[model samples]
Target: MSYYDEIEIEDMTFDPKLQIYHYPCPCGDRFEISIGDMRDGEGVGVCPSCSLMIQKRGEASNSSCGYLNAGYFSSTISSATRDLIKTKQARHI
Candidate 1:
């Protein structure tokens, strides 16, 4: 298989409940990696149904779960992100 390409962590979505980071894969599946894995310096994201993978690149921070307490705002969520979050939440329900 060809080497996985590098993708910024900003391009991925974090599931606070699952504590996993996910990005869309070309194979109609998602590439997933964990916050713990990133903390342990494991940056490779793998697809469950395909040979594809990606290397996550970004500084590890306490706000990886998209929440911060006191004096820290990583980024604002757009309507699309809100919809995606709702969908994920619904699926988990």
Candidate 2:
């Protein structure tokens, strides 16, 4: 029921296929939160097997950068972000 700590969004890994972001938990399981939950300003990442949680810090745009940097263009990342936003909106309806 209580959170262990606040984890930076930059420290988490974004799974484009799962549409979820995850960070390692101290309990050996991962702390997970969905991109949709993040977009809605939800900051809690929870470990499925435990009651522990972590507060996610930073913006979604900044976190969802697995495909960014290097030689890849910003547009591709932006497109993916747009798609994620659309998906989030669709789920609400």
Q: Which candidate gets the maximum lDDT versus the true structure? A: 2
Show where candidate 2 strays beyond 4 Å. 66-93
With a 3 Å backbone cut-off (N, CA, C), the pairs that clash in candidate 2 are none
TM accuracy, model 2:
0.67
**Per-residue CA lDDT of candidate 1, range 1-93, in tens?**
454688888888888656689999999999999866775678899999999999888754544644532222325546675565446445544
- CA error at residue 13 for candidate 2, angstroms: 0.8
The 0-to-1 C-alpha lDDT of every candidate, in the order given, reads: 0.71, 0.74
Tell me the tens digit of each residue's lDDT in model 2 across 1-93. 567998888888888757689999888999999976876788999999888999988766643563432323345457776666557656745
lDDT of 1 at 79: 61
